[model samples]
Structures are given as structure tokens and as C-alpha cells.
Target: MSPSTQRITVGELAARFLEQCGVRAAFGVISIHNMPILDAFHTRQKIRFVSARGEAGACNMADAYARVSGTLGVCVTSTGTGCGNAAGAMVEAITAGTPLLHLTGQIESPFLDRDLGYIHEHPAQLAMLKSVGKDAFRIRNPETALATLREAVRLAQTPPCGPVSIEIPIDVQKMKLDLPADLSPLAVPPVQPNLAAVDQLAERLLSAKRPLLWLGGGARGASAAAQRLVKMGWAVVSSVQGRGIVPEDHPASLGSYNLQKPAEEFYETVDALLAVGTRLRSNETLNYKLKLPATRYRIDANALAHNRGYTSELFVHGDAEITLNALADRLEGRMQIDPKLAADVKRARAEAASLVDGTLGQYVKLKNTLAEVVGKNLWWVRDITLSNSMWGNRAPVLDHPRAGVHALGGGIGQGLAMGVGVAVADAEHQLGRRTVSLCGDGGFMLNVGELACAAQEKANVVFLVMNDQRYGVIKNIQDDIYGSRHAYVELHTPDFAQLCASLQVPHFKLADPATTRDTLQKALAHGNGPVVVEVDMNAWGPFAVKFAGPPKKKEEA
Candidate 1:
């Protein structure tokens, strides 16, 4: 073919770039402004675009896809309103440090800065996107489109990764471009830690009698190194996002119960703490008031993350995987294992698990039933609800590094959309693995339309809705703070079974905890598409432990 024949439009080149980056799937809604790019994608047929009912759902799906697949999650949306709709999901992705590419379409080049009305125009859209994403860019010229996209992808995938947004004008998308013979995806190099800092961290680990390893989402890639430390008799605790980093079933793993009292007691026994890839966020640290060991050391990709939450005696700036590998290499065969310290870790692990399980009480049956029926290929996803706050976050056993995903930003409606994204990615990547999303009725109602998106795409997701018929957490808060005077918390739910029927999704209601396993089995039997299993929390009775808001005053006590 001639050089002219090899030429392609900017939109076509963008699609080709994504294909080169190994992106097999994307999520978005069709819009007039984005037609050129969508047309190119449709003609190429290289990437499967899962059409979403809303832009928010599309972005959430993309976020979850990145979390599960460890690749750049792609979402396409129109400019202005579509981008605005996607902002909340972008925030969730930012909080989770998910690598996501949000490709959006802007008005034609000629209509750039005019106050004259354009169908989907919003002033300062780039600024709005920057507020939500790690970075935002505009392709002012068709020649720079590919380079802009390359930079966006690189930034999104870089350590301390988050979402990146790029806007292409309609005219720019349509402009024809010469295809470069050597077009290749840009490679962002990983950041390496200072050798002196690594040595200092090793010295700290070698000297401690009772050492603990605290893993966070940033440490997910360092699982092998974390396991080595665990084998070296280091106790392991994880933030919720870091749940599967050490394998929750391991004897030393404390899972996501890091903020509880038993774990707090265990913290007192720790002499040195090796906190890696975690911010030790305020929520996980009991609003930064939870006591930690005196000699704390931190390993993170971002140098600025040091002393953000708790002060660390030493801070090593590098990728978690690299830093942990260095520590493992330096400390191997150099230190003596303390039998008493190992025993203490085992005891602390057991006590923490027992205390959490005991607090679940009646909810334990439901938890066990899900655990028994979910099998090994489970991705435990949850929404922000009373159950998640109480036990759901820490209850499930995740075997793989990316086996658990949730709205770490405390968003409510994202679980359903995220589950769809995860299930879609799982089907394409790890077939037969189930994505089970636990959501409350109130939260479920927030993005309920995404269930249709799941059904439309034939995603293998089972949404287990804990139907308490009210904002359970808010009700508890009101009950504690407002002298049991309930107002506006109760909500009348639609018949979920019928709603599922209308959306052509299989539905199951668990009114009795006794039938939980069987109901889950039956619901999951038809694995052709998404399923909704509603657990009637009211019929199961109140949770064993109640939310009592803040602590009471000493005088009141």
C-alpha cells in the first residue's frame, strides 16, 4: 500500500494506540460529540466496548477493570455533561490509585472558547477534569493527538497511579493523519529507591524483636516479598484495599481488621513497624488516633507521602515491589527468627479474627454461608453500608492479590457498576471467576441502572443486596444521637425480583438465613448474565453489634 493509503484519521490512530497497549475492552455511552472515535472503534473491532446506561457507570466499570486486571482501564464519554457525570467515579478511581484512561470528546475546534451555546459544552471542562483526575490534557492539533494520548497513558500507569483525562475536539478526531512506521506505546520507567535508605530499613527490620509488616494497596504488587517477610516471623496487617496482599488465610495475616481493638492490642506488642505501600489513611487508623509502634518505618513510591498520617523514623521512596524485593534480598539468611515473637503473632492473629467473628454473631451465619458457597474464584466487592463497615470488609478470605475491590473513597452507588466492570474483565481474563457485590438497598438504588448494563453485556456478576428497607447506618446514627427519633431514614423499596425481571436478570431473595447457601447456588447456577440475590437483613434480625455513634462523655458513662 502507498504511504497515503497507510494514513488514518486521528480517532483511528487513537484506537490503534489503545490496541497496541493491549486494551481489549472499554466502557462508554454513544454520544454525538464522540461519534468519530466510536465509529473508528466500531470499524476496528479490536476493542470490545461495553455500552453503559450512564457515563458514571461506564467510568466505575473502567475503574474496577483496572483494579482487577492490573491494566489501564478505559472509559469514553462525551464532553461537558458526560464528563461531569463521570466525575464521582473518577474520584473513586483516584482514591484507589487506579490506572484509568478517560477519553472524552469535546466540541468542534471552531467552537472552542465561544460563550455561544453548543450542545454539550461546559466552560473550563479541562479544569473540572484536572480536579478529578491525576492530570488532564486537550489535543488542540491532530498531529499531537497520539503523543498526548501516550503521555496520558504513561501518567495513568505510573506509580501512585490514578485516572487521566484527555479531550479531543470533534474536528481533531476527524482530521486524517500519517501513520508512523515505528508507532509504539510509551514505557514509563519504575522509580527505584535509594540504596542507603533500603539498607537503613533492613537494619531496622533486623534489629526488632517483634516486627510487623503493614501492607496497603500500594503493596499489592509486592505480595511475594510480603510473604517472605511473613515467613520470617513478621506479623502482617493490611488496610482494606490491601486485604489480599498477604493471603487472609495465612496464620500471620490480620486481613482488614487493622483498626479494631484486638489489632490495637497487637500493635502495642510491636517494637518496629515496616509499613509499605500504604498511607495509613485516617479511616483505617481510627481517625489517626489509633496507637502504632514507636519505631515506624515507611516504604512508598511517593516521597511526599512520608509523615502524611503518622511520622516514620525512616522513609524509603520507591516502588513497593522494588523496595520490598531489596529488603528481602538484604535480610535473607542474616537474621535469627524469634520463636516467642512468632508465637505472639499467631496468638494476635487468632484473637483478632475471633473478636471480629464473635462480633458478627447472627451475621456470622450469613458470612459463613457466602464463604462456603462462593468457592475459591471469588472477588469480594462491597458497597458502603452498615454491613461493610461492621464486618463485610474483613470477613471474606481473598486468596489472590486483586481478589477484593470496594469504593475506598466511601462512595455508595459504585459497587454495582464496579462489579459489572470487574465481571466483564474477569470473563475476558480469568474465566469462571465470580464477582459478588454486596450492597445495601439504599446504595443499590443509587446506580441500579447499571444492572441493565451488566445484563446487556452478559457479565457474570451476582449482586447480593442486603435489604434492610432503610438507610441502616444513618438510622443507627440517628438512634444513638437523636434519642431514637427516626425521621426520613426509612425507604420503601421496589420489588427487586420484578425489577430484575424487567431488566431480564435472574433474581433471588433470601428471607431465611438457613437457605442462604442454596439460594446463592441457585442464583449462580444460571451464569449466563448478572444475578441479584436480595438478603432480607430485617428477617435475619439486627446485627450482633450496634453502631453507637461517637463515644459517650465520661460523665454520661
Candidate 2:
């Protein structure tokens, strides 16, 4: 056979395919069932394999890598339990609509359906994966393995993107097969928008005196179009996952302070609501009870996403970037925006910022310190902590869509792993940025073992642990609803400085409220690896607003 048509193991071919797709790094644990694939990766040395301590952390890393780098994030895992370990992180990727390719191993082909209880056997493994992933595929033969891999990547990168899982039996991965002479990755074409619908929406937008644009994670790719709309005097707000679609500092951008009082007051005056590429999820909209404008319209790539939460007056099924561009073109010179509406947006934003500052109290100082040190070079990654729920999600102004990563699924303990992934991917892309993951004491301890992985990889990440010595949110809930009878919320935290010393990672503690800024600056300026910065939340005192109680209902309003 010619060199171009040489036979190679399926595992090697898979690695080569990933490399051709421009994948620079992958994350996962090594196991016997997946030895062939991992061996190939090690031998080629073309792609860096981040050895994570757990499958869940690996998946989180892959998800964040995809978000920060704007590429297909690759993750590999072994059979059965290994794949099960990644299920939670897969849910997060699904919620955030991250483009991720999860490669996993399966039992031998002969034992696949027998339920013989093999060492790594699992009942209905493929079905379980299919339920969690956007799509799941199993490679039954070596000859078609490469094609299957390409299809999985294509699907993950398509519009309405999410994670895709592919499993190859151990025998299949080791099988030798002849690859096609022209084995290149396939490029998926972008979806187009309907021009007629765009014109109709443009006309509606032009007719409204006070219109607002709501951006979601899916709108990240359409930042230019969003900016154009904002420039036309349409005020903007974002869902938590949708932060940074428009730089939060923009006069028209409201950030994630949508459910607050000042923003709610501004919403009262809005006549038109143009939502693009967002689910308008209940949590962000205060359980879908936040009062919006009377005339509502939505543009989404997924046709099924229409009317998922709150129903819109007009639902346009199309790609957000394309639709916005078409709408902007149609409304070119025929639009006139009210000056009063612009002034109102600016005033409302200032008021909201002040309120958040007052609520944050001592944490407000930390936030400003971060902005001063990192400026726009920081990638704000957060776990589900009180600090994040209260301020981190909305307070910071991310200059770019890729600069913010959060646990959209509302899960904790994934932030450290995600931050490491973001840092590594950013370094690979030469973005020259630092990833700061804000975690609570409880969340940080959940996957604290992953700190070793960060040390090993020397990932440029700062893990800021807000040590309240307990589940602050849960405690607040008990105080409000259960008359201060707290149970199972108190937690014991390790001396983070000592823990970091054991891992050979830099460590800092912010025990003094007055020295908070200096301590944070020193931690962030540390070497290119994971650093643990523990903030004494107790010293900072209580927050002005408690976010633990049940969301206020629309009927109450």
C-alpha cells in the first residue's frame, strides 16, 4: 500500500483526526479500557493530554477550554464508571451550550450486550450517555471510526452547540485499519437566517420607543450585531451565562443585573423586548416573573427553543448573528431612537451598580482591586458560591464573550477545574490572560484534589476561596425560613495555605479586611500555576442583601 493509504490503529487515527481539527489539548483520566487511545496520544506528543484527577473535573476543563478558546474541546475517559463520572460536567456543558467532544471507552465488543459483569461493564452505558449528551454515537467498526469522530465533532460545533459523546470498544480502538488517502476533517457550514422575518422584526423594533435587547450564551458569536443594536439606542441586558456579549461598561449594557430593582424599574418603561439566543431561564428572570415589555420577540437557532420559558409575540427560528445582521441591514436609515430612553438606561445602570456595591460591602473592594490588576485580561470563572450569586456573576465587566465562564448548571466544585482548562487553552491560543476561579469553602473542597493536576500542568489560574467556614447560602435560608435552626450547612475547611504548601502551589490568605487588595494583588501576580487565595468572609461581615430565600412570585408583585 502507498504511504498515503497506510494502515494504522484506530486509536492513532483518532488522535490524528483531532490534530487535523486543530485540537491542541485534551483532558481525562487513563484507564486500561482506554489504554490504546491514551498510548497513541502519548506517542505522538502532538496534543497535550491533561491528566485530571477525576473524570468530572476533566469534562469541566474541556468545557471551559472550548468556551475560552472558541474551539472544540476534547475529553477522553474510560468505560463504565469513568463515563459516569463525567455525566455531571456534561450537564453543565449542555446547559451552557458549550462545544465539547467527549471520547470514552467501552467494554470489549463480545461482552457489550451480554451483561456479564465485566470489570468495566455498565448496563445501558450508551443509553445513559445519550440521555445526558446532545448526541451520542458508538463506533462499531474500525473502518468507520474516523468518519464517526468527524461527525461527532461537526455536531458539537454546529449551532445550538453542546457536548457530544462517542464510545469505542477496546477491541475496536486497537484494530488496524486502512485510512482514506484524503483523511481531512469536515467543515460544517453555518445556518442562514430568513430575510423576510428579519425585515418584519426590524419594522417592529423601529416602531417601539423604548426597546431592550436580551442576550444569552448563544449570542456570544453575534457580539458585533449586538453592539450595532445597542448603538441604535436599544438598551441591553444578559442572562448569567450570556455576560460579555456586550462589554458591561457600555452605557447601553445592563450586565446581569436584570432581576434587580433599578433594572426592573427601567423594564417598566420598555415597549419592546428583543431577545436573541437565550432561554430566558427562570432563575435569571426570577422564576419567569420579572416584568418585561408588552411587545416581545425572540431569535434563536434551535426551532424547538421557541416559547420554552416565556412565550414571545414573534419567534424567529434562525442563527443569531445572521438574523441580527439582516435586521440591522433592513433598518439602516429608517430608524429613530428616543433620547429619553437612552438617558433612562444610563441612569438605571448607575443606580444598579451603586446598589450592588452597597450590597457587596467589603467584597466591593475586592472586585475593584481585581479590575485594577487584571483589567480586561481576566477570565472570570465562578463556582456556585454566595459571592458569585450575589456579585461575581454581574459586577465584573468582561470585555469579550470568551472572558466569562461559569457553572450555568448551578453546580459547585467545578470552578477550579474549569479555570485550569481556561488558562491552558488561553495559553495555547497565546491569549496571554489569567483565569480567576471564585469558589466557596465547600465548593473548593469538593474537588480540591484537582489542585495537584493544576500543579502538574502549571496552569496559570488563581483559585480564590471565599472561606466562610460553612455553606453561607444554606445558612441564610435556614435563618429566613426555618427560624435560624441550621442543620447540615456548617463545614470544616482545611488551612488552605497549608494545603497549597503540600501541593507545592503558591498560597495567600486575606484575613485582614483592610489588606484585602494587597493580598489579592500578590496572589494574582504569583507564578504561572494554580495559587490558592483564601478570603476570610467572616472578617468581611454580612452582605447587605440575602439571596437565599425563594424567588418572589409575579402574583406578589
Candidate 3:
């Protein structure tokens, strides 16, 4: 065949387009619907495809991969049931605002949107995808497949970024088209700030003595600008997603302890509060009832974010990086910053640490032990569990923006798969970093099959399963608020050692609190592949203070 006759199928176009856009890895479960695209990936051998046990696991893996790698994480799935299976994970990505691309197969063009019974057909699948993600698209014409993919990626990486999905029909995937000459990535223009608005914010903050900066998920890309603000005597506090934006070890960094008594009290004294790219979510703000500084300013790419969470005195519409750098440029050496602000921040941080330390009980040892072993560089991934709620979120203190990954949407059972994604991204970037997924027995069991996937990929991850033989948080809530009448919280505990043996993965059990360090070390030393370290929470006992549920206003409590 002549060179002009060698037309490319949509499957091959997707493969080549992703590679051109710098996508080094993708996660998915292979099925007949998506076999064509997977075949292209296999034939090209450019993007590393991670085969997860389930669609949920695959999407969760992609979410975590984007978080760790700071790239466009990709996931592929079959049509109908398979696409629906990925919705929960897609919601998590949307909540975290991760830049991810989800590609799923669809039924044949002839059978499209028909109510008649057909295999792998979901009537309104595109609507479902749009509901769970930032945006969703369907490739109706084979000729526009590449353009649709490019637009999806552009939207996913745009400011206020989130996951975007594209559904291509199996028949369309097989249709041949002339390859586009240009495969370069789409260019998304930054949301530039209004200089007048930025100047007004700078002027208002110029007289402030105690200025505070609240960083959130949207500010992750502006770490360098945030650091400059810190150097200029701004005290830093972050939401969970914003941890490490200013290096938690910095004396002025509050490190997600924003709602702790010490930090809340400190907020009252702050004369100026500059909230950057944060939603000030209910979880972190006591459902919007927490008192904040009287004078507040907010910068965000999403204009709607201005007055939704906590009303700001001035709202600057722009990307976090651009607005922050512009603010720093205007305020440098001009503001009347307090000389003792750093000391005040240090005192607040110390008090917050003390408050958390008093509630760890025997697990304080576990927290400290893990800190010593994992140090600051290890990638910390967590699910919603008793352990993470207690200490896992703020323990070791991450130093880089990408060093932390967690279910920002408060989902359970995503950590195990997220760990696999983190490990894959680590390998692809040759970062040589180890990942530890902190999960509860209940959540771990939810995605237990993914452990096999981790083992198969030889992912560098340690699954730290905190086994309490129940849904500890639900039980705690029931005890505190429901007259101690436990219902379905208790679960039949599994023998993790036996389970690990079946998967040929190394396992270690830490029943004694004293063995926390040793067990973690041993698991970490199993460097070749995944390892499971089960912390016997039942044997070890309860925390010093019970976290029944999220903190609420005094009236709600």
C-alpha cells in the first residue's frame, strides 16, 4: 500500500494523540468494547497500560497517578456497565479537581441511543459521565475524533481542572481516517487577573499586621508563589488537598490543621486573610460556621468560588499562580507586616500539634514510627479511615506539593488502587519513591481485588491495613450519637496473612504497638513488589480521644 493509503483508525489515533500529549501511562480493565484501543496501546508500546481489577480501581488509579505525576492521567473502560463502574472514582477526581482523561468504548453507531436490548449499552451514558466529571464528550463523527480528544485534554488541564471523559463507539474506533499533520498538545490560555482588582487587594492588605494565607487544592500549581508569600511574613494554613504547598515544616505553615482550636483562635487575630484557590469546604470549615478573619480576599480561576464558601472582601478572578505572583510583586517590602507574626504562627502550630498528639493514645507510637521510617519524601496516599482521620493526614509532614494523595471527596476504599497509580507514576518518572496506602479493614476489603493488580505490576507500594474488624468510624459515631446501638458496623475480619499468601505478596502483622517500626521497616524492605502490613487495631486498642464524626458547630454537636 502507498503511504497515502495507510489511513489510521480512531484507536490508533487515540494512542498516538495521548503519546504526543506526553501521557506516559494509562489505567483500565480490558474488555471487548475497548479491545481496539488496548490493541493500539499494545502495538505502539509507548504508553504503559495498567490493567486494574475493576473499572472503579482503574479510575481511582488514574486519579492518584495525576495527583502524583502532575500530568494528564488517563483511564480507559468498556461501554455501559464498565463506564458506570468508574463514576464513583470520577466523582473523586472531580472533587479533587484532578487533570485526568477518561476514555471509554461505546456500542456500534447503528445501535446507538436505541432502547432495544443490546450488549453493553447504556442509554444516557454521556449524561452520566458529564454528571460525575468536569465535562464529557462523545465522538459522533470519526473525522472529529482527534479534535474531541484534544478538547477533552485541554478542558481537563484548564484552570479549575477536573476529569474529562470521551466515549468512542466500537465501530468508530475501527473507522479509518487520514492522520492529522499536527499532533502537538492543545494550548490552554491562562486566566489572567484584572490588574485593577489585584492592585485593590494589595492596597487593602498593605496595612495588615497579621496576614494569613489559606491554600487549597486549586493552589497546588502555585507552590513557588506561595513560598514567596511565606517569606514575606504571611502565615500559611492549608486544606488537606493543599498540604505541602508551602512545605508543612515551615514554621508559619499550619498544615491542614485549619480547624483545630489553636488555628481557629489564631484566625481571629489575623487582620488580613488571603484565601487562594480553596473552596473552604464544609469539612475544613465546620460547615461554613467557623469564624475567620474579618477582612478576607480570595483569588481563584473559577469566578463562582468567590462568595460560595466564605464571602471575601475582594475577589480576584485569575489563575492562582498568576494572581499570587502579581500580589507578591505589588506587596514586596511595602506592607507593614508584623515582626512577631512568625513567632505567633510557630506558637499556633506547636499548640495544634500538641492538641493532636494528646489524642493519639497508643497510635502515637505508630504515627511517630512511620514518620521515622518513611521520612518526608515517601508518597503518602490515604483513604477515609479511622487511622487517616486521626493522624495519617497530617503526620510525617510532606515537603513537596505532589508528595500527598488522598480521597478529597471523603470516599473510602480508593487508597489501595490509588497506591498502585502512585507507584506506576513513580516508576514512569523514574522518581524512585515508595508509596504507603493507609486504609481501614472495611475500606481495604472494598477494593481487595486490586491487591492482586499491585502484585502483578510489581508496584512499589506498602498497603498499611489498619484492622479493627469493623467500620470503626461508624461505630464511633453510633456510640456517641445513637445510644451506642451498633447495627452493621461490625464486619467479619479476614485473615490477611492467608489472603496475602494466596496472592504471593509478603505480609506482616503488627499486633503489638511496640512492633510498629519493625513491621513497617520489614514491609518497606520488601522492595521488589507490593506488601501488606496489617496493624491489628483491635489488639492495640482505641485512640485517646474518639473522633465520632466531622466536627460541627456547637449547636449541631
In order of appearance, the predictions have TM-scores of 0.96, 0.97, 0.98
**lDDT per residue (tens digit) for residues 1-557 in model 2:** 66667787888888988988899999999998788888989999999999999999999999999999999999999999999999999999998899999999999898888878888888788899889888999999987898899899999988789999999999999999886566677887766767777777877778787889999988988999888888887899998878888998887888888887899889989999999989988877778888877778999998888888888888888888888888887776676777788779888888988887887767788888778777876899999999888888886688888889999888989998998899899888999777899999998889887899999999999988999999998999888778999999999888887888999999888877778778877887786788888888888788777868435764753
lDDT, candidate 3, 215-305, per-residue tens: 9888888999998888888899998888888899998888888988999999989999999989999988999999999989999999888
Which tens-of-lDDT digit does each residue in 357-412 have in candidate 1?
Answer: 77676788888888888865788888898788777888778878888899899888
Error of 3 at 189 (Å): 1.9
Residue 150's lDDT within candidate 3 is 92
Clashes of 1: 0
Global lDDT scores for all candidate models: 0.86, 0.87, 0.91
The global Cα lDDT (0 to 1) of model 1 is 0.86
lDDT at position 310, candidate 3: 83
Measured by lDDT, the strongest candidate is: 3
Worst 10 residues of 1 by lDDT: 548-557
Candidate 3: C-alpha RMSD after superposition: 1.2
Predictions: Cα RMSD each:
2.0, 1.6, 1.2
Superior by lDDT: candidate 1 or candidate 3: 3
Error of 2 at 453 (Å): 0.6
Number of clashing pairs per prediction, in order: 0, 0, 0
